[model samples]
Target: MFDQDKDTGGLQGKVILITGGTSGLGAQCVLRLALNNASHIYFTGRNTKKGSAIIKETHDAGCTTPLTFVECDLTKLASVKAAADKILSEQHRLDLLMANAGVMNQPPGLTADGYEVQFGTNFLSHALLIQKFLPLMDKTAELPGSDVRIVQLTSTGFRGAPSGGIRFDDLKTVQNFRVLGGMMRYGQSKLAAVLYAQELARRHPNIISVSVTPGIVSTELVSKQNAFHRSTIWLSAKITQGRIYSPKEAPASQLWCAVGPRNEIKQGAFYEPVGILSKITTKYTQDEDLAWRLWDWTQSELKQWLD
Candidate 1:
């Protein structure tokens, strides 16, 4: 275990950003980082009400650190860009960027931009956010003793992805071909996260980029699943009898990645809970060629926004 208690105080004066900070693991991350005394914390979510509640909750907890909520709906690229631009215009340095918001096992659909829903919301939006912030992150890394990190949250569910990792041929479609359509699409999106982190580390050596799994937490992401999918989740839970962490307990690895000593975490690696560098048996996840290809594809897709 990664102990949050021991990790306190290091984040003083650090600037941090998290996605989906209104609830679940994202909310917990906000609380933890605020408690750790981060100088300024910016988190993104669609719910202004919940965002306000989080700020209040943090203040009530006696964490006087400033928390700003950037209204963002990841389904729309334009909204993502607006949020990024706002943050970039305001913040001089970004020490940590946590790509933590995501949907899991969602029904077949497309984003506002016409890509598969999970792919767009989970992977592409975070990609855009990271891309938009790289310059500031680079500047931060140049400062003496600055430790800039980008943490992308992925899942072991990537095992369920299509054999090829990502179905590039039909990313613009719903990807409803197979029996486990939702999971397959979810896995595909998450696999993209892992590959993207790897590519990011290669391209930006100054930043520490890694993907991580929270190890099956119970959150709104689970409760929002449709009836059939919910039952499948229930069945799996019963079979494994696995320990499902609460939001607070689940973000240990992410927090550790965000603030843990720079020498301890490998650049561009995948970690399980509490900073364990997991061995990725899936061959596709280890494919450098596929990682680069996905990077090229993402850049092409987001060319307009990038310009």
Candidate 2:
């Protein structure tokens, strides 16, 4: 377990951003960072009511740190760009970014950009957010005592991706395979997240980029699932004898990655809960060529939004 008392103070004076900050693991992250005295906290969520609630909750808890909520709908690329632009215009330096918002095994659909819903919401939009903020993060790294990091939340489900990993030819359509279609799409997006972190560390050595799996957390992501899906999850947990963590307990790994000592973290590595470096057994996740390919494709696709 993460020692909140010991680790929470590490973020003092740091500027931070978190996606999907309205609830679940993301909301926990926001509260923890705010209470720890981060210089400023800028978070994004689609619901204005929930956004305001987070801000109010921080204030009610006597957290003096400035918390700003930018309304963002991750399913839309235009909204993602606008959120980035709004933050970039306000803050000169951003020390940490937590790409914590995502969707799970939902029905087949497309995002506003015409890409598969899961892949677009989970990976592509976060990619655009990272791209927009890279220059600022790079500059932040140059400052004295600066430590810049990007934390991408991935999952063990990445191992369940289709045979060839990402199906690039069919990204524009819903990858509705007959069986396990939703999981397959979810896995592909998460795989992209892991690969993106690796390529990011390689390209920007100054900034620390890493992916982490929070394990099975008892959040709306699971609780709101249909009865069948929820039962399947519980059965799997029982078989594995795994622990289902609450939202408060689940943010430990990502929080540690965000504020832990720089020397202790490996660049471009994937981690399990509370700072354990996990080995990538799947050959697809270990492919350097595929990582580069995804990076190039993402860049080409988001070129219009970058400027």
C-alpha lDDT values of all predictions:
0.90, 0.92
Clashes found in each candidate (C-alpha, N, C closer than 3 A): 0, 0
Q: In terms of TM-score, which candidate is strongest?
A: 2
- Candidate 2: regions farther than 4 A off: 239-241
lDDT of 1 by residue, 25-78 (tens): 899889988988788999999999999999999999998899999999999999
Off by over 4 Å in 1: 234-241
Worst 10 residues of 1 by lDDT: 234-243
Q: What are the root-mean-square deviations of the candidates from the true structure over C-alphas?
A: 1.5, 1.2
Could you tell me how far off, in angstroms, the CA of residue 52 lies in candidate 2 after the best superposition? Answer: 0.9
Give TM-scores for every candidate, taking all chains together and pairing residue i with residue i.
Answer: 0.96, 0.97
